[model samples]
Target: MALDKQDLLFAGLMGSKAVNLIQNANIVNNELINRVLPVIPFLPVKNEKNNVTSKSGHAINAEDNWTTRDSIEDQKQFFPLSFSFKENGQKWLFPYEPMINIASGNSIVKRNVAKQGDKLIGTIKERWSRKDFDITVTGVLIGSIMQGKPEDCFPREHFSKLFEFLKHSKEIFIYCHPLDLISVNKVVVEDYSFPFTKGENVQAYELKLTSDYSYELLIKDDF
Candidate 1:
């Protein structure tokens, strides 16, 4: 299908996946994290590769049956923050993010204090380094809200995936509205742990992270 304003809007919300419109639209609504106002998209012409009828199973035209993703639609709601960070082109959709805090600063010191003419002065020094950043994110996972089947809504798999990231030594690409405010693209998981919670099927998680920025030669010599 030809591109149009509606298609672009879908692109803005779903990223590249908008082309598929909503794959699995046939699935139950509760199974999907996107429980928001429905938006329409113009799907591409069905080809052999997309024989490929997973989303909605209708490739001929845009469908009003599709709904918007909570995470992608807005961040101000904060009831359930959507996918924040990704790695290798995959985004981690947070079911219900309660809070996300980012703290950033730099170390500048004062030295060489001296008394001169009944006055005191000190020299200030700063090193060429990236600003320090610390991030904390808390989210609640719910499987018993009758939102979906336990197999689909449970947090056990989410917990395992989170642990995998924590155990991974390498830095992972991360982005959210808050992280974007400070230009933080990647971070190292300093510590991760599960906090006390009150639900039989609800799990709370706490993730601590420090920023990681690899410096590259921005000014290359043009020969």
Candidate 2:
């Protein structure tokens, strides 16, 4: 069947409009992808609480009452970050965004059994009643190191030794509270001190570890 000129022109216009619609959709999709990709690191929620130890060797749950800005948007704007290392090719990359646990106020005690001078004995007695605290770190994993070569991600040297240790391990151990699993975020390492952030949306996230450290070793050995 033969179509009139007007009908043919209308069909051509519709086709052009459809093509423009598709191009616009593609552009929108690409923009969304780019916006979301960089947000992955900040997405995982990390929750941590405090534990207090008594001089009698008993431990108690201490409140995690550290305060921070309420909104996630505020956190994104003000989150303080430190650097760590990852291996690439023949050298190490500095300042990789590796997962780490920051534990504060952990302590150990020793009893004095020997009798001493009056002042010394008094000091020991006072010490026995006092509690000590220190900060310790554990469960460091380099995300960029474990993942494929970063397109242009810079690495940091602070994590060099930790990266090496993870490289040689067969299995990494994670300790976490059972209750944390059911919460919004999974706790990666157990018994780590986490500062408190305020707001209704505040939550916790679990850190990732691997049973096979070989992958880490391969990446580190690349350098």
Candidate 3:
């Protein structure tokens, strides 16, 4: 007996779902999430096979060997901040003076000095660096409030601040655990691509926040 077209379509859908479930399960079991956590920096390293070993078991290719000097040179700097309700007690103080300028083609730099009264904050210096791709972000955990109240959440205010800061930023970074799944439902930023990198046993995401801020987030494993 021949199966109906609807039945075949339903079977195909079920098969697709099954394949997706298996793929997802494999991803989870392999702990791919830990590799993409935004807070952690991923540095590329030279493979050991490339090393030339002498009779003394010492690597002869010193210049080609992986060293801190080269690693530091290739290092991509990133900064991220987390806010919580417990830290600030109640009030939120957001006194930020951003030095990043996209039009000027300069890297963001910030300096702080103690004063008698309120803190003095402003851009002290701005200059373009050869390492323009290197980015630094500082997140101030501007206290959090109860989630029960709509006003307390300050969703719009928080989004506004993020928008203003990311207006010139190339990317935004986020950190999460393997179990910490995220949804794009309420995210305000637009025009961005997320590239996820996996480690030997974990997963992470490198978010290119263009038209936004670019950053990385590594998903941690449950201990």
Name the best candidate (by TM-score): 1
Q: Candidate 1 deviates by what RMSD?
A: 15.5
* Tens digits of per-residue lDDT for model 2, 94-195: 122222333324233555757766666532332333222121332122222211223211123333333553354233332222222422111122233222
> Can you write out model 1's per-residue Cα lDDT over 1-223, one digit (the tens) per residue?
5666644543444345435644333343334324432222224333444212222222322232222222233453433433334554676656454456778776666466555444545463645444679988755554422123344334566666667777877888775666777777788888876765433345566788888888786878889
Candidate 1 ranges beyond 4 A from true positions: 1-88, 122-130, 145-154, 217-223
In candidate 3, position 177 carries an lDDT of 22
Tens-digit lDDT string for candidate 3 (121-210):
554555444322222222211112212233332234544444453453332332212102322111122332212222221111121222
Q: TM-score of each candidate?
A: 0.54, 0.19, 0.19
lDDT of 1: 0.52
Best by lDDT: 1
Residue 36, model 3: Cα distance from true site in angstroms: 7.6
Number of the candidate with higher lDDT, 1 or 3: 1
